[model samples]
Target: MSETITSDEGTLIQESRVWQAKGWTARVIKNEEDDGWAVAMYKDGEAEAALIGPWTMGRDKKNPKPLDHNAFNTLVKTASEFVRRHEQQLHASLNKSLMLNADDTDYKICLQIIPDEDDPHAYLSAFNNNGEQIAKIKVRPDFKLNPSSAAKWLEQGFQRLD
Candidate 1:
């Protein structure tokens, strides 16, 4: 029978091979590719696992290391960083921005990608100095948003095209 214990953030199940804490869950399972073990980390309420990698065996070499306080804390830190970096990368890919130094007006131009299975889209928007959106236009999915590119687009009356 698996033992369940209440942790500060979540629960720990020895038999089921799960350590849930700090809005994340670290689960150890048998590696399908070989006769080894792997650990999967999932964010709270997320269906997909965020990270999965090999797990170290205990001293006996036949079982995974127990999820003790130290191990659990370390796992939480590693898993948290992994999730953080993944989020940063996702944000960078989906959204981009650049500053405009036009002679009469300054603006911040942004391009945000809206991903959809059937119809992917993007938006090119410009915000004035007061953080007010002055112009927003729906653009193609693969619009390049960078300093030089944004400047050129703005120079051409905010019309972006290849």
Candidate 2:
């Protein structure tokens, strides 16, 4: 099921049914942007989103093709399935891998994923032993983290002063 919501910007957004998982929830928002519309899947009630991407544009540019009975039904099915797959992958990558290492006091590292608003990438930040940031990596969510790179950083043992 989906419902239309008016955002603070006064844009009319059609929101999909909420998909909930461990520590996270996702919902697809349609008609939320000027370019076309977007699907934003984020943690429940959080202002900062984990993921937000543009939805497919309709054939007509001026006006979106009306959602007829068949179209609306098909869209609901397809979008829901896609959201399910995305939720699973996001949970596995973020919840499983990224964390603050407490084992090595001299080389303590913290990893964070910050989603960008104007871009389709996430910013990965690495902080060192003193809780100071050392490096920032721009990564696509689909990009796999190179284990070699992580290992090399550990070997170098550079403590981030700031």
Candidate 3:
């Protein structure tokens, strides 16, 4: 049985092979692909582990190293950074922005994607230097959001995109 401890820091489980604290859980498991060990790091409330990597073998060379405060902290830091970078990449891919000068007025054009499984789409929007929205229209999710497309849209006076 696994022992659970609650304290000022947070809920913690410091078993030999399992450690949970700081909104993360680290589990040591046998690597199916080889006769070695692996560690899985899961963020709290998430069903799937965020990271899985090779684990160091114990002195006996047949078992995994026991989880400890230092090892668990390092795993939490690595997993948290992994999840953060993934989120940033996803956000960058789904949302984009550019600046252009039209009629001597600076304009900011942005594209935000809505990935609905049934009806995928995106919103193309423009704002003036004053931060006031100038135009917005729904466009296909696959709509290209690049300098050429943005210039074309600006040349057309931000008309509804087909």
**CA-lDDT, candidates in order:** 0.81, 0.49, 0.92
The numbered model that scores best in lDDT is 3
lDDT of the structure predicted as candidate 1: 0.81
> Which sequence of candidate numbers ranks them by TM-score, best first?
3, 1, 2
lDDT of 3 by residue, 1-162 (tens): 367899776778889899998888899999999999999999988999999999999999998889888999999999999999999999999999999987899989999999999999999999999999999999999898888899899999899966
Return the lDDT, model 2, position 138.
Answer: 59
lDDT accuracy of residue 71 in candidate 2 = 43
Error of 1 at 116 (Å): 1.9
The digit string of per-residue lDDT tens for model 1 on 1-162 reads 357778785565644477665677778888999878998878888998877889888788988876655665787788789878988999899999888899888899999999988999999999989999877888888887888878887788876455
Which candidate has the highest TM-score of all? 3
What lDDT does candidate 1 reach at residue 16?
Answer: 40
Candidates 1 and 2: which is better by lDDT?
1
Which pairs clash (backbone N, Cα, C closer than 3 Å) in model 1? none
User: Which lDDT tens digits does candidate 2 get at residues 83-162?
Assistant: 68988887655622333443554433333344546765544456666677777655564444455445555555533211
TM-score each candidate.
0.79, 0.28, 0.93
Question: After aligning candidate 3 to the native by TM-score, how far in Å is the CA of 4 from where it should be?
Answer: 2.5
Cα RMSD of all models vs. native, in order, equals 3.1, 12.1, 1.9
RMSD of candidate 3 to the truth, in angstroms, is 1.9
lDDT of 1 at 72: 59
